[model samples]
Target chain A: MTPIDEDPPPPSPAESLRMIAEQREAAERQLSPDPLVYHGPWGVAWLVGFGVMFLRHGPGGTVLVAMPAWLPLAVLFTLLIGAAIVSGVLAGRTSRHVRGRSSVQGAMYGFSWFVSFAGMGLTLQRFDDGLSPPNVGLLWATVAVGLTGALHMAGGAVWQDRLLFGLGVWLTLVNVVGTALGPGWHSLVISLAGGAVMLLLGLVLRRRPAGRPNE
Target chain B: MSELDPVIHAQARLRVVAALSALPEGDQLAFPRLQEILGMTAGNLSVHLRKLEDAGYVEVTKTFSGRTPTTLVCLSRRGRLAFEEYTAAVRALLPPPST
Candidate 1:
């Protein structure tokens, strides 16, 4: 018969506490939210949604000759909403697998978008009679950019993530440029430039190895 | 002696509680995942987990994700409160910080 191995001596109380402290530190590092998980999908959604809106409303003011202006807006709304739902589900599932903290943070982030967009819609309705179609579109674009920028910045600050913070600053600048240049230029920048940036970010995030810290 | 929780005083159990406490409320870690993180053998981990379960510090769920059976462990509200109390007691017992 094989002899049984003897158990090792238990650690001293002080040693055990110290081991716990070390483990805690390691766990904290492991538990922090990975940017790619949330940001990748988020960026893609905005990119596609905004890109479609830009094509319809840019300087030329109608890419599809047969389609009505309202159709473009409708499409944009559908795409954004669809993206949000899909991304939310994906984030939830991924968090479950990884035991990640980003699920709550991502939900809060989505809430910010809902509030911003809904507020803009309500404000527009209040001044519906006074505002021109172009003016309304511009207001929509500006609000979207502003809110997105602010939310990203807030996320960056909360998470201490430089990439998110940088993206926020860039998006804020895009808003400034869009507001200054008018709706056509604004749409062009957001669709082409902003979309590209977001898409690039998504791809980069997708490629990043799991369990790696953003820092 | 007065500061530490008797249930949480042991090294393995303390590690288990600490790991669970780090997770968000309602989140559970699979037994294998917890074992990997805590660097313990399956049998050892199970024994410690059973101890925690008996103490009302953690709740374990046996569920299948597809065909494979999984044991997921989560800290209960009681467990969280106890951990908090234990930490506070430990802190109170510590010496004042030096300038």
Candidate 2:
């Protein structure tokens, strides 16, 4: 066999500069939090939880109308709790090898949800005696959906992700329309529309190349 | 020539430091992930990382994830400052922007 040189010649100054520039761009990309961390599996889990809740309680809730109202509530509570646990486990496993603002952002994102939900719960409780159960549920749904949409927008702002921000805007519109339609239709709207959007986003994230910018 | 930070001046070391600096404060990247991101061989990456570690510019932590051992890397405070200074020096070498 003919002898071949094992090593290539050193890069010219122009090549070296180009290489450095490329590396710098890659490094800059890393500054942003990984979109998949929040948008992929965790997002899907939340969507699933919300979808189940809407189907049980919203207008589409007719399927479960025969069952005790408390039963659906209980099931929703369990499903959300279960989803939270699963999301936590997955986050722990996947985040083991990665680090950055993602942990902080994730924590903040979660805190926003907690605060929004808690506030909605307390507000609903304060007016509990005045409103019918379904009416109260409708109000709760509107506020909760709106709050989540706002939070998602805020998160998008922080991460500079247009897709996330767009989702937020869409959800906010859904909340408005659902509110006008009242409890039954509102739940159905959120379940079908919100769930579909979230599912699509999750799948898109899953298919994205790892570490690529959200843009 | 501008006063470049020799510690971060090397191509490999500069890339490593740049990547670490890109992370949020106190966050880190696992060794394998960093290696993959930089597209360097494990041995080559180790050599570059050792130089930075020796200079106290990088911090390396060995931890276990279940049964597997993992190596994590992060830029130290000094490293961040050094990289900043290096970038500033490079910018200084460039001519002023045109009007």
Candidate 3:
């Protein structure tokens, strides 16, 4: 193994004892939480919040005359429904590595979300006449939201939690596809499909890991 | 190989060897658990573990009982000697307690 970033200089024995006490105190705080219930609901709440925000705006102004005013509602529903499905995945599979690894994985997921959004942004500029300055601004905000999802996922991964990783990937795909379709048919289909997939994945993640200790 | 003396030799391996030497037989600690107990991170714990294994002062066992892999550290006969020597050195370093 590559040698660790140089070994820390040894503290005086008394100092070492103090440090040990501090670390133990911190770890105790982490392990003391009701590991299953606490983190599971925490993950669920985040996804629910994401879903609520997507649906609250009640869709954007209609682009096609033939399309009903309610078309935006359909789009919003797809996104929110997808959010609900994936939140289940996040809560179920993310418990083991929650302490140290989740933070790093969450950040990485955020970066991936941005990269995917940037790709979608350039794609949107190519096709539609309706792509106004404000619309472009919305896309940027979507990109930021995607980044938040990614960070949460990455953080979960670092902590050795699959739920976080699954959610991160799910959100990244949603943003990428949502952007590529330019707020119309493509985004709707992708969101619905991804949400369905999350529903399935949550079932698998929630099961007990073979031979692992109980939480 | 680096030249080594019996006395200065065991100084570097002191803390970890001390910790493992104190454990009851067959109970092994995972890296993070050791880190918490010893107030060290995985990196620090692994480093000392490697050194102790090299000197035959401790035996390192890597195995997975489940999804998470485990690193088991145990004292070897030779390690038990080095630890005894180390304890002697530490005692030697200290002045006797006043009666």
Candidate 4:
């Protein structure tokens, strides 16, 4: 058989592992404290809040704790918890995909978030003239923030759920819209709605898949 | 065609395939950007990449990003054809659903 007819042998386990390591390293090199890490955390924070809603709603009424009258604080706490959980889950899943696949997984990881974040941008601009004109300046500022978050989420995709990147983007966009929409209390609606969407998205990710194992 | 053939297929490498497959002809990825996307150890990735290089599936080029060394990966024509063939073969193997 001609050399052209012969297919290249598939990559070895060691080689596959090596590629993942390299991509992870490259991600780290590009990360910066100013944006990638910070916005990343912010995006994760919202995802966790979305996740918690599932826990709260899935289980029947446990004793509800009524604390002080600080609405902002309440939202903050929920957001924190939700982001943490979502971030953790996403990280684990992305990591698993990366370890089993190749750098293309990383790109898939990045592309997903980019699309979600971009979608959020489009959604927000369309709804700008709502009850509260999203702090126009702040909303614009958050774009940079979202990009940073995208980078961070993608970084996590290095070893976490490749799909988590999409979750991160959606969460970040929803929060950005929520923040622009109005006071925290009102924003709760956005969080709840976003959570529902994320749950569906997660299920979808669990279903449809990327093609070809990295060789 | 080998069905269920086990080779070095790992997460990062698979990621590379997915990324390349998505692009128009000749679109490439820089090493650092890819690293951020995959989140693996550098030493580990480089070794696998070298194997891809040797295999003629991926082409790597060294250039200067400022003064730093940057490696870019792109799907070689051969690699693209192989992937296309592999995908077609996989699709052919899928069981048809009952009406």
TM-score of chain B taken alone, every candidate: 0.92, 0.93, 0.71, 0.78
Candidate 1 iRMS, in Å?
Answer: 8.1
* Number of the predicted model whose DockQ against the real structure is largest: 2
Q: Write the per-residue lDDT of candidate 1 for residues A46-139, one digit (tens) a residue.
A: 6666666666666656573444667767766786676677766664654554432455666677677778778877776776567887777888
Greater DockQ among 1 and 3 belongs to 1
What TM-score, to 2 decimals, does candidate 1 have? 0.59
Interface RMSD of each: 8.1, 8.8, 10.8, 11.5
Score every model by TM-score: 0.59, 0.62, 0.31, 0.35
- The DockQ score of candidate 4 comes to 0.12
Ranking by lDDT: 1, 2, 4, 3
The alpha-carbon lDDT assigned to residue B65 of candidate 1 equals: 82
Candidate 4 is graded, for docking, as: incorrect
At residue B86, give the lDDT of candidate 4: 51
Q: Residue by residue across A65-92, what tens digits does model 2's lDDT show?
A: 3555666556546755665576565556
Q: Compare the candidates by lDDT and give the number of the best one.
A: 1
For this target, which candidate reaches the highest TM-score against the unseen true structure? 2
CA lDDT for candidate 4: 0.49
- Candidate achieving higher TM-score, 3 or 4: 4
Greater-lDDT candidate between 1 and 3: 1
Give the Å shift of residue A147 in candidate 3.
1.9
Model 1, runs deviating above 4 Å:
A1-37, A60-66, A94-110, A211-215, B1-44, B48-99
Candidates ranked, most accurate by DockQ first: 2, 1, 4, 3
How well is each residue in A14-126 modelled by candidate 4, as lDDT tens digits?
44334444543333333211222323445444445423332332223221344333443356567655554555455544333222134355557546765766776687676
Across B29-74, the per-residue lDDT of candidate 4 in tens digits comes to 6665565566657876676667666778777787766797777767
lDDT tens digits, residues B1-99, model 1?
Answer: 464567776667778887777666756777876777788999988888887898899998888889988887888899999977876666565567889
Model 4 misplaced stretches (Cα beyond 4 Å): A2-68, A71-74, A77-188, A203-215, B1-57, B86-99
lDDT of 2 at A33: 36
